[model samples]
Target: MAKVKGEIVINSERCKGCELCVPVCQQQTIAMSDKLNSKGYHYAMSINDECNGCINCALVCPDGVISVYRVKLKDAAVA
Candidate 1:
């Protein structure tokens, strides 16, 4: 079976920007965004094309703001 690629989403509102998820991810997929949230703190955001579906970001996020969405596969045969 082939592994499918996915993307991880982080919610800016709930994030405290504690820099907690930065060291947890082995792939270094998550990075602090320049934009600040409503709380005026720089929140962590995933770099483009960096996530590898390891779910490390989701697991480490204290605010439960991370979400993983798998890419849909195209059907090889016409229905």
Candidate 2:
């Protein structure tokens, strides 16, 4: 079986800083930025590479600011 890895992209300008996606993430990869966006809000950010492509954050985001990408890594023996 292959292992799944994921990446999360966020449009800081589009984000409203609602913090809706923060708690929904099971991996706790999402966080609020220390800096503010152009809209003067703390945008969402992926704090680490632990994302599993769950899409929970994307689904909960009202502004559609989050994007998730997943890749599969084959076993080392197979590689």
Please list the Cα RMSD from the true structure of every candidate, rounded to 1 decimal place: 4.1, 2.4
Reference-based lDDT, each prediction: 0.78, 0.90
Error of 1 at 48 (Å): 2.4
Query: RMSD in angstroms, candidate 1?
Result: 4.1
- Those runs of model 2 whose alpha carbons end farther than 4 Å from true positions after fitting are 77-79
lDDT of 2 by residue, 8-77 (tens): 9999999999999999998899999999998899999999878889899999999998989988766873
- Provide the lowest-lDDT 10-residue window in model 2: 70-79
* Local distance difference test, candidate 2: 0.90
Query: Model 1 segments beyond 4 Å from truth?
Result: 71-79
Most TM-score-accurate candidate:
2
lDDT of 1 by residue, 33-63 (tens): 8999999989998887655577877887888
